[model samples]
Target: MDDGRENLDREQTIDRLEEFQKASVRAIEAHGFELKGERNGVAVFTDKETAKRSRDTFRFIAWDKVSEVADDLIRGATQHEEYTGVVNSSKRTAEYYVRVHRSLGMIQLRVLERQDWEANERTCGHDFTPNPPISSISALKPSGEKRTVGFHVNSRQEKTCIELSLASPTAEFLTNPWSFVSDHPLDGGPRDYSLKVIFDQSMDEAKVAESSLELASRTIFELDIRNGISLIFAPRERVRVSFDAPREVPRIRFPRVKVPREVAALFSFASETLDNPPYVFLSYYQVLEHFLPMAHRRDALKVLRRELRDPFFDENKDVTLIKLMNSIERTKQVSEEDQLKVLLRDFVRVDKITEFFKSADMKHFSNKGPISGVPEVVMHLKSDPLPTQAAKRIYALRNRIVHAKDDPKYDSIPVLLPRSTEANSLKPDVALARLLATEVLINSQD
Candidate 1:
């Protein structure tokens, strides 16, 4: 539901940033606000004035999530209100604020929340959901206390199957779950989102569901991050769903590649909890880092092979043996950055990297420089290839994400936790990390 639900999100400020491009015309207009104009990616709204002020007719300033609003619009609109919005994947639903008229000469926004605005009596009570003229609202009204959901099977065979059931009398009680936005701002916040997952598939009998538990578990974590709801699988727990799920097979796509469980888990883990930007970036980087030890060993193997190939090499002589030992030690003693460089050089495809950055979201990375306080990834053919530059950028970012306080290596990055506008902007970077990690994992195969 698009209705505003306000719980004390870790740092609510950053999570609540509204994107101007994503907000719909209907929702924006419903508040009696019109898209008066736009400049520099900001859509300025001029609605009926909140007060009978002489000069300032438009007085609401909103922060756009992806792009910064025009400074002129901000200065013109900041006479009173401040709005931030978030629209869901469907784009049909939204979670944003509506201005509640103030009597005490201060602005108030109506939203469902645990606490009042500065404990003000004039503000609407907690449990309040934004009343957006109702005409623009589309809500899923479940009939009874529990809603029945048809879970479809994702089989290679004809999916036109029969209804799935379980023998237990308590079958109805054991439904899969979804977290409504209102659920976030409340436990008692009037919304019944409890759902049941069933199909011709039975967990009790066949112990089967379309997607594997490991994959489903990862999806559940992503839901928690995106929707701000915590969902853990119940012991002896089962299946889940997506609304008209897309045709996405070969989750890795194309040729079958062997990736270790550890690497796959790390890669999946990065996707699941990405809303927490700093940690997510770190996690993604760790996917590449996992191969660092193996990378070191590969270098050592090369050194040993070179010595063994030399016909004049002698193990009996102290000088020759000591030289080999010295060579191996030197090979294994490269910096973390150097090891990462080795993995990228050995595993990832150069042209494919150029292709990866060609993505719409990722293109800006080539121009905008690195996320957080890190060096830019300068792509060159020979001296500074994409992989080497990538290593430099990733290592610098890793350092920044690690240290809690001020440090010379990463002082440019600040400590404003999940206040994640910048972190949220890191989807492209995350994708890059996933690409590199998957490449290394797949390419490392025998």
Candidate 2:
């Protein structure tokens, strides 16, 4: 057989299968359980839980691969040992036995049942002799396949219990939550022998909350032996784990925002709806964020330069436009011979202007006609209207607060820094900036 025959996709399938098989083996070995045998490619562990878990994982693999292993298991299963239990009775004794069937040989319980005269007759009595109808019992099929068949023996008067399980076949029978014993040993088996009542976190509310409270609980399991004589209780304790790990928040697709048909759509609106509804209005912020890219792109710059009507200023002059014009005229009126030197000096004084000039060759601009100054450059910028000359200072303070840094008057602008400090609440400025940005963006797209 080709070991490397599996392709990448098929290899993943096989690798997963191999991992599951190895895990099964490790678990069984860890719990001191023995390995039964290999049926086809599937390795069978002696623990019933291991076999059951493997069976569950196997169903997840491809049907074709599953069938191949299943067929192999059937062919090689002749000598397979299956764990089984039986209830037997004779003229002298009534008994129950847990046994293992193997391909090589069979191993039966040395002593599983005891004589109980009280069980034979309803009243309390001590009989030394084994009861009537003693018979040896064998499984009709493999115990691995049977989900729930109780090998039960009970008392007439009080509760007596005994049971074995393979449900979580790999799970340890002794440590299993359902397999509890009382500390104070009583006569006979546990009153209730239930295998299905396993400690599943999903089922128990107390266990789920226990982790937070650091609480632990124990269950008592008992088995009663002959005529109220032998009683045993095993205690299984479980500490509650606080709440389970939080589930991941599901991703939500934001609803599309459609612009009015009369108004041209310039940008997309995207918002996330969280599990808890936010009380504040976020539409204004969303609009601003959506509008910036559409308005300021280089390709759309030509269109914006035409439609950039001054929203804040009026008929004769926009505040920004007027400033630009005044600055331009002031430079032009200066004597041609001294204009370059004075302009260069002003450029050096302005931080932004100095950087703009230094970014390119100065000699080229000296030879060229119109040398742009800081104010001139500001005119060309296609950004939202300036919130404030002090906006940057307020933003810096906000940043300090957000990052857990202690700064006095964090929300309040200090009176000392007159130019940097302002009383304008960012809420309204932010809203207007968004609307203005949208206006610029839609017009630019035209």
Instruction: Supply the TM-score for candidate 1.
Output: 0.46
Among all candidates shown, the one with the greatest TM-score:
1
Please give the clash total of every predicted structure, in order: 5, 45
For residue 371, give model 1's deviation from the true position in Å. 2.7
User: What global local distance difference test value does model 1 have?
Assistant: 0.45
Q: What tens digits encode model 2's per-residue C-alpha lDDT throughout 352-378?
A: 433434453434233131211111122
- lDDT of candidate 2 at residue 303, scale 0 to 100: 35
User: Could you give the C-alpha RMSD of every candidate to the true structure, in order shown?
Assistant: 20.7, 29.3
- Per-candidate TM equals 0.46, 0.16
Off by over 4 Å in 2: 1-163, 172-203, 207-222, 225-446
lDDT of 2 at 161: 26
**Predicted candidate 1 versus true structure: per-residue lDDT over 1-446, tens digit per residue:** 53222322323333334554434433444444454443222233444444664432321222332122232122221111111222121111111211222351111111111112223312322222222211111233333222222111222232212211111111111111113322221232222121112222233322223222333444346434653334332222111211123366536557577777776787677656644555667776888888888887887798899987888789788888888889888986788888989889888888878776654354445546435566665545477888887777777667656657856754556553332344445556656776787688778886
